[model samples]
Target chain A: MSASVPTTRLQATADAFLTRFAGIKASLPGDKSLRERAAATVRSKGLPGPREEAWRYTQLRPLTDVTFETPLHADVDAQALLGRLPEIAAPHLVFVDGRFRADLSTASSMVRTGAPSFGSGARPDFDPMVALNTMLAEDGVAISVPHDVDGGTIVLASLATGQNGRAIAFHPRHSVNLADGAKLTLIEIGLGDGVYFHNPVVTVSVAHGASLTHLRLQTESEQAFVLSTVYADVASDGTYDSFQLATGGRLARAEIHATLSGPNAIAHLNAAQLLAGSQHADFTTIVSHDAPNCASRQTVKTVLTGKSRGVFQGKIEVARAAQKTDGYQMNQALLLSPDAEMDSKPQLEIYADDVKCSHGATVGELDAEQLFYLRSRGVPEAEARAMLVRAFLDEALEAITHEAGRAAMETAIAHWWDRQA
Target chain B: MLEIKGLEASIGDKQILRGIDLVVPSGEVHAVMGPNGAGKSTLGYVLSGRAGYEATAGLATFNGADLLDIEPEERAALGLFLAFQYPVELPGVGNANFLRTALNALRRARGEAEMDAPGFLKLARAEMKRLSMPDDMLKRNVNVGFSGGEKKRNEVLQMAILRPKLAILDETDSGLDIDALRIVADGVNALRGPDFSALVITHYQRLLEYIVPDRVHVLVSGRIIRSGGPELALELEANGYAGMVADAA
Candidate 1:
């Protein structure tokens, strides 16, 4: 009976989402046939539950309790939310409740709005969340960089304003394509207030000799639920560098699927999750090396205080032809309180021999000696602990190379520490 | 002034400091020389409010305030400093930032204005120069990957910057060469004045040759068995602690 509880609730949630798709299918502004197929898939499979091996550590039971409504087209004064964005000097494309707001955005020539970009990189059939996004995506951007062009920095921000105490949910489908020898730095930000569900799916394609630096900052409302999925495909001599700093959301998960389809491709998936109270966050990544001599690296750090829990699941897959693959992964968690918990799973499936693959995970409280040393230097206990926690996350945070992006991340981390202290 | 009366401390049922009594006046530097396992380091830990070393019975006062009842940071703000024997490494905390934070914390406690970053950096560089520390030392993480001598020098640098009224140096001269020893001694000597006092704990008489102490106390098995002038360190160097233990018995 206990096992059947989640199953029944999961079916109800799926039915609700399907019903939502049916109401908005005529106006969702995408491939109608594709949306129909995705809705059919959701109707059959339902939402992924605890029974699924991929989501075993992070239970979706809490999301089932909230009745999420379709976000109404209400006029939201985004001035306050705009001020909370990082002080970067780039043009921005702002989306209010997952629909593009041209008045709030600083227009960029390379970006296109008003149409959902259903790219070929994401597999809606394989992942249930991506399928849900396919069924209901209303507004997104299509960004393309020409060959050999250095398309500086651009900000993509999504703000959810749950109006009148109503729980709302939004799915934004986005796509990015970097031509050969092109470069782009994309800073994606998620911020909101009140109870809402923010589900976004992004598909990225990096052509030969191109590079894409993707930095994501997720600081949604404490009462919000965020589950985002990203699929990236890299060609020969291309690079996809990403760092996700997740410090918000009552229940959040970010899953990334990166595939290196050409030789000499590189992918770096670095993240830091700072959580407190009853917040639960999961960062899962799968790096597939399909070509010879490709390299992949991941470093995920989690700082959990109070009764919060963090999860990290990283898998490195090397195909038979992908010899000399250099893959490394490390997940570390710093549990401040005795009740805080962490779950880490590192899997490596290497069909090729002669590959250099290694992974490590460590979970510990702050070192007593380190704490004493700082306190003895006249720093108070709380400040000392915050400093030590920052130090513990330095390795993972250092992977972010963009100056403004790094500064924004530091500010977010400082705010997180401020709340904890 | 710092005074300890009938101090008895134990580490998990194993007594280390038994009925110890000592005092360092406002303008004096004293030395506590003891052999291995004689509780020299334990005394420092117990006074600095480190965890896991319990004071079963004692009354330690600093300037008429109860020291044992306060937290470590409070004691530090009260102008009490302890130079650790083995400095713990903070891998991601820069030395300059650590020093400024400590200084600002102390300043806030004392109701003084906080120093600006430029002002603090200038002051830190001057002290580091006095200790022969490179400018880049401030940029590196605190005590991480530092050589033994460099670690000792950093402790002295911290002492020089903090300028505490009373400092307890716990085996600071243990791993120093002659040159480093002189530098450390000079750093301490620069702060010696009517308002400054220190308790320099050491095992050998070598450090005393540079920074001569006003008084020397020989600790045997947890109790101070003998007390004398600077010559006591040399006497112990000649006769060894075995003779002093036998004499005390």
Candidate 2:
């Protein structure tokens, strides 16, 4: 299970998987050059290794140990998967088993006009998953909000189905562009049942003076494996607020990389992870302040029960020239059972002279006195514990601005707690 | 309504209450005053079923039922409330929400319907107004950033909302100004009825002026030494527990 084995295995798997991409890659109706270049760059990079800072907390051994071919264009009924989540009303883009299903997706009339365009820039040397996704990923959903557009939200649902014994792997690529002065809320839900692996890469670009609030809900099955990456670039005077609620998946790791590339850019990253049984969840984030007068805040809260484990590692870096930068990070975890464990590391790397950077981490159990107080008030023992757990997670949930999105996340959390109970 | 006979309790093998006997009947306010380290708070905690106090030998009964075998919430459901001396500050839990939850929990336990949001709000507002507490206190986190008098007022607010049959005020009058003390006293006075009983644990007799007790007992070294009327509190306040301890010895 060494790191090099996964990298080498993934490289060979990618080479074999590229044969099935010939048809999908040739059918590029809009931009062939960008697709070809992206594919070439990905073939060269392969998959990411442990040396990469973004992939440090997560090990891809579980995903790469078994060679997986690009899943066929399987027949999937997304309506069956989406039981009651329609309450999150928005333009729905459904991707089943790594391929976009236009028939299962919502009506085109719900699609907003003036969609922002996406460009595939020069690929980097590292980040093999980004390269692999760029080279082999099928047609993904592109959502854009033009400059000054309002009153619209796009929901992207990626669902995977495992019908056979062979492990199914899906790489979903999404690019979101927010025009200057535009405001949009995006809700991305990664949900699947059965035993499968899903690797999703989402790129968000916020134009000058625009604001984008992204909510990622990861509630996959206990037998499923998920590795999600969110890459965001904030422009001058723009705001980016991202939140993640992870309560499912046997082993789920979410990486959020936000770069404040313009002056006066603001970024808020918050995540809440609730896991029980043998579930494992890792929330790793990196916030980079590249320009002056930028501000970033990150807070991660986790609650672990049974034999579950929670990991949170947050890093805030302020560049040398990023003067007057304000960055703060905090990660707190609560372990409910004796066998439960949590690991948290909050780090700050500040090279700017006039920057205010501070980070803190705490890992412990529920306060005994608080539990006693709640129990003394006639709340049942189990109900009191749940209330305390909910209160512990409320800090991160409060950071979500969208009322409907927050309510949806809370309901998901409650459902998970009910299952545990 | 409550009886403790031959009660002996300890913490980590060190007996705090060697042997205690007391009785608080219905429609009476009994004040237990003593010097520091006299186990005043321990008595209140033990009576209300707090943990960490091992009852080596005790026989406590409340309304003809054995109280020692019940859990804290069960005791609370049976109409027992202990106003903490140092009320814990629960961050992120709103004061209004906590009170409503506690009240509704008790109600449901007693086979009563839960209070609606509007009804709960109206009752909370009236109680807050009666206590002279600011309206904003209801919206803030429970006891977080609250001053001493504010915490005391919060306890009184809970008393008003829950309306337990037996209220144990463990040093409730310690950190309060005269005006705040009068408000708390008025809250307790309003709840006074033929079926209600209270055990007030305090040091000074100053609070007795507002909420006079029918009987005052002097607890020295975990045992009640003397019992008399309200005049006993005044006498102890003037002479202090030193003379009383010497006389008992």
For model 2, what is the alpha-carbon lDDT of residue A187?
A: 88
Instruction: List fnat, each candidate.
Output: 0.82, 0.51
Residues A343-412 of candidate 2: C-alpha lDDT, one tens digit per residue: 7777788888999887888988988787777767777677777778888887888899798888889899
lDDT of 1 by residue, A127-215 (tens): 89999999999889999999999999999999877676899999999999999999999999999899998999999999999999999
Q: Pick the candidate with the highest TM-score.
A: 1
Q: What is the C-alpha local distance difference test score of candidate 1?
A: 0.93
Q: What is the docking quality class of candidate 2?
A: medium
Model 2 misplacement above 4 A: A1-56, A64-69, A107-124, A164-166
**Candidate 1: which pairs clash?**
none
- Candidate 1, superposed: residue stretches over 4 Å from native: none
DockQ of 1: 0.86
Query: What is the C-alpha local distance difference test score of each model?
Result: 0.93, 0.81
Cα-based TM-score, every candidate: 0.98, 0.93
